[model samples]
Target: MNQDFQEAVRDTPGGTAEGQVAVVTGGANGLGEVIVRRLHSGGCRVAVADLDGHAATALAEELDGTRATARGYAADVSIRAALEQLLADVLADFHGVHILVNNAARTQAKPLLEITPDELDAVMAVNFNGMFNACQIFGAYLAEHGYGRIVNMASLAGQNGGTATGGHYASSKGAIISATKVFARELAPRGVTVNAVSPGPQDSPMVRSIVGEENLESYRRTIPVGRLGNPAFIAEMVALLASPDAASVTGACWDANGGLYMR
Candidate 1:
């Protein structure tokens, strides 16, 4: 294998994304935050988009102290117009985008039967509609550019029907997994690779909020790794998937579920 491919597999701390431009949704906190940091550290110019503008700006300021490698924007991905504006702003600042990481999502742990229609709709708006908007907008941009990376954030719940999440959340993620393949096939011809990363229950703030400490520990005991996944673990996978070295890796859903949902 080539050294670059090996480096991508190992996810080393280097400029794998050197000079590239990337946009990450829900990048203000949790797994998205870690992904933004990792890509920036890999020498990529990153645009951090989130609903919480202040938090996003704070993170961007913290990471890009020099304000040269990263910028943050407040955006609601559920709104197609907002996403379009975000795309325009990112292009204006970064000139062009080479990577798009769809990491924004909402998680609820209610029982399937108890999940109300409103709850399902709200979750779908963010988890599914938001992702679709980004893919459609950025996916087109990448296709036009003739080369890019698109990493959609999925979950183990989608594949295994939610060990710790609800039906609404799981179903949305399942849709994302399916959409990844469709986009992958279509964009491949344009030199754009689309893929998804399905992480097991991680110790992210979202997961913690959904699954309390007691339940989290209970779930951890069931995993073969015996511990909840860390945000960095998921971030590493996004880093690899966003890197130029990952050009040949696409149209697949990567598993980082600590053996909880082995395929």
Candidate 2:
């Protein structure tokens, strides 16, 4: 970690997340990386889990002795076996899991007519099934321990039929939102709060790939905020939901879309 960044994190106050153990999937890059850093600065023990083991481990090393406790794990969120192992490892290493951020997702930009079966399935597997696997495995741990906070990453695309990635991506995210509601209801009795964060077009790696340069300017113009969303904004929202302050908030979809999709 940069000494300057570490110092800044240590000095910051107001939203202290001390003693919380959080698992952020897809934490190796882009928005996920930003979220991991923010959670760390807020004084939480963070586990940066991603499919890329090297990246995950590298991030962990970077924050090894910073203000917040940190570690990394490589696991495929889409696979049940891998997710099971990940939950076990996280529980064993951290002693308990307090928060789970289901941020791992994939998008397809193909038109409906040209969408292939395999491609569609791949998107669903990563966006929807991956969330289920994490929720089921991690939720179990939280339930056993009697407390947890779960934040599922949905998208404005899911709410508005997808502006860039097409129907397949939208469908998967919609499923995530529905799943969030279901999990919140089922887990509430166990002292677990489950919610979804639906962000509009952001300048993340995932959005950049789906929203090409030619259309990026036009898309920004269409948003009521007249600018692209920031990863920090989304990270802050996730941190809030994961905090004990949001204990009463459950089964709600927090929209961070910059007025792109109002409901």
Question: RMSD in angstroms, candidate 2?
Answer: 5.7
Model-by-model lDDT, in order?
0.86, 0.84
Q: TM-scores of the models, in the given order?
A: 0.91, 0.90
Q: Give per-residue CA lDDT, model 1, range 134-159, as digits (tens).
A: 88999888777677799999989899
* Candidate 2 off by > 4 Å: 1-15, 65-68
Candidate 2 lDDT: 0.84
Residue 234 shift from truth in candidate 1, angstroms: 1.2
List ranges where model 1 is wrong by over 4 Å: 1-15, 215-218
Maximum-lDDT candidate: 1
User: What is the per-residue lDDT of model 2 for residues 1-263, given as tens digits with 9 covering 90 to 100?
Assistant: 23422332233355355677899998988888998989888778899999998898899889885523788899888788988988888877876678899998887677887888988888888889999989998898787767788999999988988636868889999999999999999999988899999988788766766667788888788889898899899999999998877879999999988897887
